[model samples]
Target: MDVSNAFLHGHLEGQVFYQQPTSFIDSAHPDHLTFRSTLSDASLFVYRQGSTTAYLLLYVDDIILTASTADLLRQLTDRLRAEFALKDLGPLHYFLGIEVVRRADGFFLHQRNYAHELLDRAGMLNCKPAATPVDTEAKLSTTDGTLASDASSYRSIVGALQYLTLTRPELQYHSAGVPPYARLT
Candidate 1:
């Protein structure tokens, strides 16, 4: 599920000065001042029941809630709705770029779509599949090759690959040693 305008719900701590949006100006509180609140801790809230537990993971505006039973899940959802405006997206299939597939054994998480998009962006969509993502024995040195013309793209792809490591541990072993600015040799 997703929260509508999640950032706006964040409570400012201390003194915050800002001109209210013209459209949202309140005539009653023209000189409105936001005060510190305990809302920031809402991102992660967990509930436990004996051997069972319910987990709520919040990333900015997106929220993923899971529980061992349907009744518990429903109770949590209702409580959340009461506190904030939430749009229930129903079952979890796609989140961030990870695709979740439920199986008899358990839930499987993959990032095929995200990987495809990354490959396309790198103009490697049609590239041949490699037996391994990187060469283990290849030695990369700073003085080995000329610098890439667009270092930003290289850094961007590396950053994306770092995120891809969430579902691809193999990539982590290969990429963990590569610095963001390391040029191809």
Candidate 2:
């Protein structure tokens, strides 16, 4: 779900003042009820009461909500709509570069489009696919390979891959090897 002017939904505490942006105006709106977040991830908020349970994932102004039941989902959406301007984006297909494919038994999530864009940006879309992205047995060293002529491009790709780790955790192991080479540039 997309929140319209989501930033405007925050409640300012105490005396908060800042130079307004171009054509900005002070407006007030009630924020959502307090939801508990786990220690592992602050962005994921869980709301549970009696037999009803709902999970709310907050990423910047975007929100992804799911419930234990269809009725609960409607109730949750209605409650949120009462407090904030929410535009339901319909079924979840893509968010934050990750694509979600809903199946009869489960949801399949992948970053194929994101990874494709990353490779396309890196000019390696035609590169052959390997069994593994990195050689797990190989030792890594910054000075092993020649310095990257385009260090900025290399850094940008590395950063994008770091975000990709959200789904492709296996890349994280090989990830460390790339950063060390960044300094070599």
Candidate 3:
């Protein structure tokens, strides 16, 4: 999932400008533009080498890769590193705020770091961690507490939790509930 041309491959409704290329030095018009922009797909790119294959993922400057062979992976990584300024974050531990965990059971994606970030952003970072998420016997109702004056904030927390559920199905009950602060009130 590589963005072909990436920044140069997107549609622009308004004007875009850039300095002339070093190779295309314009002595006649030193300040003149050397390139005109165009629109194309930025979501995907394909590169093939013999029978082995590699996939490049590009989101702006961020990239992830999958390869059919280790040698191919190494070759692709080397080539990419040489061409672009990149950091080799080996083994894909984290991407797009989702944490990747490999276990005997299977691969798991969780927002543990993302969750922590959200909690910190919402000032819940230092809150005590409950032994369990919610009390099984605790009955939840819509009319439980006073309406939050900033409903948007409450909703934002819920939305973050909802995204967390992509890897944390077990937390669905806890994530989708009315705002925890409201519940306390």
Candidate 4:
């Protein structure tokens, strides 16, 4: 599911000020709305009422919601719709670069598309997989290569690869050697 115009939903306690956007204003009626900025985990949110529980995972405006029962799921979704301009995407298929496959037993998630995108970004789309990603016996130094010509692009690919860790734990074994905190937030 998704929240439409999520930036407009913030209700602040104190006075907020914003300029009237150029395109929307006539010379006469010049009023504008303001919103508060906030920071959050962008992770999971759990709701519980008696024996019923609902789980909501949030990433920016995108949301993945589930509940203890089908009825609860519908009720929760309806409640959200009332509060916000929520778009019902129906069953989950693809989210956050991960593909969802549903079966009788359970659901499976993978990042094959994300992997391909990463390879393409790194200019390795047609490259074959290496027998080993790195030399087992090789010793590494802090100063290895000079540096990437475009550091931001390098960081972008590394960050995308990091997100893939949700579905590909083995990727954790290989890294860009860039400090984790060094990446753009």
Candidate 5:
């Protein structure tokens, strides 16, 4: 469980100005009105108390959190609720096409959905599944006059393969043409 608007809950000092709400535009002080924008994606604020720590993952309006203490998490949740309207999504699930499965042994993260989506986007969804991405016996070369017509698509496939490495660590060696850790063997 995590606080829903944890970023907005912070005490903001100094004067900030923003356009008035569309419905409640004040005619008198419209020039001096303000609103607070959420924190940026690359920045995050964390709080720790004793053995527990709360992480505030801020990506615009969306937030994800993990805390050691349940009571502290609830307290943070209530505080955030009082300050701003928030939607609490209980437990972690799918995020960015990555499926997170929690089990008694450990957690498993997979990008099967993401892989399927990438295949669809690249128009390879209906194509037959190849036995391997690359053949170890054959060396690929661009100098053979096989210029890539769609460089962007090639790049996209490369990016997808890079993402796959997050869970499929073994793919790294194969992508780099290192046969030692190839997925085949």
Candidate 6:
């Protein structure tokens, strides 16, 4: 489910000051102290009842909630709706570039589309798939290859691959070896 204006719903703790925009200057408070809250994995909260557990994963404005029982899920959704304006997008299908498919046994999460997009962004959509993401025998040296002209694009692809490893653990080892940006000494 998606929360409308999720960031605005969060409670601001510390004091934050901001100058008024030239167009929308508030006469009451020309210079205002605004409070904003940022969400992270550390903000996740779990509720357990006996063997049943409900998990709440929060990533900024997006939230994924799962429970062992329908009743628990309903209760949690109601509580969240009461606290914040929520738009129920029905069963989870796509989230954070990960496509979720429901199976009789459980759910299957895949990033096939995301991977394709990444490849396209890297101009490697037509590239052949290798048995391994990285060659085990090949030695990568900083001085071996010339620097890429588009360093930002290289970094972007590497960053995306790092995120893709979240669902594909096998790629973790390969992705970990890649530096965000290439450097030559």
What would the TM-scores of all predictions be?
0.63, 0.67, 0.48, 0.67, 0.54, 0.63
For model 4, which pairs clash?
A: none
After aligning candidate 3 to the native by TM-score, how far in Å is the CA of 61 from where it should be? 1.6
**Count of backbone collisions in candidate 6:** 0
Model 1 Cα lDDT, one tens digit per residue, 68-100: 888878877887798789999988999988889
CA shift of 178, model 5, Å = 15
The per-model lDDT (C-alpha) reads: 0.72, 0.77, 0.64, 0.71, 0.63, 0.72
Per-residue lDDT for 1-185 in model 4, tens only? Answer: 99998888577899988774434545463532111222343277676667988888878899998889999888788877876899878899989887898989999777777777787989987765554555789988889967889999989987887777645665655455642222211
Q: Relative to the unseen true structure, what is the C-alpha lDDT of residue 66 in candidate 2, on a scale of 0 to 100?
A: 91
What total of clashing residue pairs does each candidate reach? 0, 0, 0, 0, 1, 0
Better of 2 and 3 by lDDT: 2
lDDT of 3: 0.64
Choose 4 or 6, whichever is better by TM-score.
4
Q: What does candidate 2's lDDT look like per residue over 21-117, in tens digits?
A: 4333335533444457767887898878679888999998899999899998998899999878899999899999878898999998777778878
Residues 40-81 of candidate 6 have per-residue lDDT tens digits of 445465667667778887777788888899998898889789
Greater-TM-score candidate between 1 and 2: 2
Tell how far residue 12 is off in model 5, in angstroms. Answer: 21
